[model samples]
Target: MTTVLPDLRPGGGRSQQAVGMPELLQVIWHETRTSRAAIHRARPDTRCDLRISASAPDRELIGTILLDGDCACRDLLVDMLVECDRHLSDRAGLLGNPLGAARVHVRKKAVHDWIRRRRTEVGAQARVDRIRTSALALGLPDEFHRALLEYLADEAGVMAPLDSEDALHRRLATRCAAEFGGAAEHYRARVAAGMTLVERHCRSGTRVNAGTAAEPDKVTWWERYIERPMGRRPRRTDKPLVTAAPECGDGTHQPPEPASADAADFDAQVVAVLVAALRRQPVTPDAALRAGLDDLVSQGLLPQRCAIELCSDCNRFALAAKELSALR
Candidate 1:
């Protein structure tokens, strides 16, 4: 006979150590896979497969779950976030070749137009912020909170360049990652130190989430049916999310700008690349600007201001450096 695991949900106390990040992630994926419908609701929530949508309507899809206190589907928030990011990136030429990466470079104006066209895609941050609201209201384990924030910060870095309209905190966090070290360490530290891009939401809107359990416990049922590695499987979430057939690179992404298109649009792409560089991820500002100037400048950008600006001036760059010197 298959034996069910004991309830191991951590009590709201320090004595119980939170599960490690890798294991916590596994548990979350499993919850996403196995989510069930609540017994009662205005309409029987029919999204049983839990396949997440990659379009604007995903807000409604995720909202349906987070707001429905009866199902307590908030636990799947992390996985939902993961799926959204993957779908968006994949659709945006996530492949590293210049052509693919170029296709990934969707301009902000076009980003809106693209979304307007048919709700083709969604970015990760906004949706995760929704989860952030719930996570804050119904407390999460300390490590879990930090990890969630770190994940947000990391995703912010990944998505920052593609869209310039990103939050300043997130942009700066990625900039810090670029200036200091890289996303994994620098922003991870900031998030642990209580800095993150998560802005506060309206307090009154959170009331509907009250009845749901803070986070559902994970199951160890896999240990019964199979070995540790392959045994684990996630249940499908009850409320199904939209899914689509794959496209070559990004389905909605326009082809690379033609020679006739405004050259400035192509020049702006350097910003995305440099931002990535500063964050030290895939590598994007001065660097971006230099590239833009390299192509646009008839005489090319000046190498220096008489080669003495750094040595002679008390400019912001100089002042900034001196200020930084105070750190150590």
Candidate 2:
């Protein structure tokens, strides 16, 4: 029987074979984002809430717009932002030269914090990535592939192999029967027969034991388990949307005040993005910040002047002040 590259993985358990690509994406997105949020919340605070005085300069209101998928929105946002930046530079030139630089520095720090947080979260997400890769390699969708690998990894040691023809025959029979009983019984019988045939003909490739005592029923088993039966690809599951929440250690009160929606939202979004970026090894804090800023700016959720700050230790965003309005 011919096996697709994807079907060759000898081991993911029944459950792993059920997870599809979309589901894997969702799991990765959720777990990475969640961990990032938690770590950010736990980070030590940075006093970034700048006091906006009565004489504060007017600037453009910027926000990030989030869209599903790895699409072309990023390029579009960059083009638009480049065009809009002339006004910002001009305004900065007017701010006595040094103030503009200072403001830029502050914003950079905030963005850096966002990147650091992502790296932190990414640290916890390696397993998801590996599982997804394994699934794709095996030609299984996120649902069955990932779930099966995870199940096997968790239940049986990840090192276990499922390559033996005998093992394949037995498991496939059991799976077919369990998942599709009525039609599968016929499949089970057919595979059993094939196993018997392969055992007779194939036997040991080196040892031509054509006349030996029943050759392990290899051909009949292979035919019944692999060649004859019909197999249905499992459906992929939809990933549930996740909400990024602040952790208790975030130094901010839970259920932020209704009036403080702006700050709270800003905090949540920046922290979430930051956390997501930090998952990379040999992490780049600046790149992570740029990622978060780009996400927010594209979404139109942040003003041009707002900034994000990272904690030195955990590399996630930190809210230094207890009061939202006190600094802003």
Candidate 3:
């Protein structure tokens, strides 16, 4: 799935990268201008409430654009965000001020408590980069040519490993099936093959095993889920997205039930196979994020019901102040 992201100026690193929220908002708004209004007219289902405001505010206008704007531009702005939360750990080891680790942890959590659409995008990008690299090294022939690993870069976590436990993994697989108009298993197998190649290479080289995972005190991603961003990506914007999903902490929500027993069973089997395969591979960031979730579950630190419930309440909120176009 070569996605071919809209000319989001993927090479746009000069002035845009350094700009703050206000400027970034203006830039994307400018870029998405014409397409925004057209889409509102094109998609009558959006029920867009068009109101002209001469002095409303750029923030509110951006929110309206993102809520009902073109998907391509919306995706591009998501990619353009800079991940700025300095980390205390990654796939490497403990980093930053260890003496102030607790304080830093709190501060980082505070950052996460803000908009996280960018960080989530970063995670998906990270998965694509590493997995794509591993795919090349293993001579998998253009990734055995798995799905091109590009679409997810624009959307959500579509590049996730087939067997991994991230929320969007199955969503990608399902979409792949729909896009190709069937051959569901073939698409699923491509995803699995990408992960399998990583496992194969790691088993053949120096790597970490489950023993290091045997820590009695619950090591957490502190050992495994380090971010180690090369250059910070996806910085937070000052405002939140007014159209973002509800947060997980709310009590009046419910976890999404599976469409059927068969679908649920299929997802469970995929996870089981993926867990077994990855144990033979290295605990890189991809391994850690996916496998770490499993460890948390097995240790009873994160129960299945709790994890499922959070998905319903929605851990997927974007900044109220993000992305392009439509003005009415």
Candidate 4:
């Protein structure tokens, strides 16, 4: 008897001889991860020293190396330190210190405090910008936008004395729906988006009160009526009916084309695969693109024939996952 060995090439198993593009992508991803892990293990705890310099108004500094594993923070500290030094030298005798050494300490502390305050203000402004952008995207009115900013700034009290921002937003959205006659769901979505923006900004750093600006455009009373629910209009029987004759010429009307079952099944399969992949691992852009595709292919949900179209769809899903992750 002659001994025969099985072909062990990519996708050469008994199931299917040709590998799908998604499976090939998975192989590449696995190899890439293995290589990265090996490289990380080979050179773990590697230290890097960086030197940064900037030109000041009246300062001549050669260079300084910052160490502490956070080069960006160190660079910022050095810049702030140099700025304080310049301020001290400029106001040598103005601060009642002839040698400028005694007041240097005080001036340094003031400079650092100023920087902290400025950073807080900038972060607050960023949060306000995000809230405004979200409101604009939701098509919220100018009055509602200002109210949201005020709420974020803690300038207004909640209706039911709620402790959390979420509760406050819910109450405010309900009030907005009642007052504006707009869709409650739309207002709730806008409020949620605004609250999320403020919460994310607060979590990142110290919270500061956001300044409120005048509304960009004024809404007239007539414009407000547009948001209100409109009554059904009466039907008119003025036009005569005009139906086209059958084009087949046999006097038999051809039936309308039915919806594609294959397309619907493909979409449902794609969603199922994405949900399974996300549940397996937290959805990230990289993980969704590679591992998600791998999961779909391995689970036999994605067909080899539809690999190319599915790959494009997977890319879109990956981008959406990234945006959702960022919001979280």
Candidate 1: tens digits of C-alpha lDDT, residues 226-246: 111111111121112222244
Best by lDDT: 4
Whole-model lDDT, model 2: 0.33
Q: Name the lDDT value of residue 13 in candidate 1.
A: 23
- Candidate 1 yields a Cα-based lDDT of 0.31
Best by TM-score: 3
lDDT (Cα, 0-100) at 272 in candidate 4: 63
lDDT for each of the candidates?
0.31, 0.33, 0.35, 0.40
**Weakest 10 consecutive residues, lDDT, candidate 2?**
230-239
Query: Which parts of model 3 have CA positions greater than 4 angstroms off?
Result: 1-27, 33-122, 126-136, 139-142, 145-328
Alpha-carbon TM-score of each model against the true structure: 0.17, 0.15, 0.27, 0.26
Give one digit per residue, the lDDT tens place, for model 4 in 1-328.
Answer: 1111122122222222333223332333332343334324433343324333222233332222222334233333334344434444454434433223323443346434543444343222212334445433244445565555444442131112222233445666876688678866678877887655543433444222222455343332111111110101011211222233567878865433323359787667667666665666553443444455555554555433344344334335435566534533
What is the TM-score ranking, best to worst?
Answer: 3, 4, 1, 2
Residue 191 displacement in candidate 1 (angstroms) = 4.2
Clashing pairs in 4: none
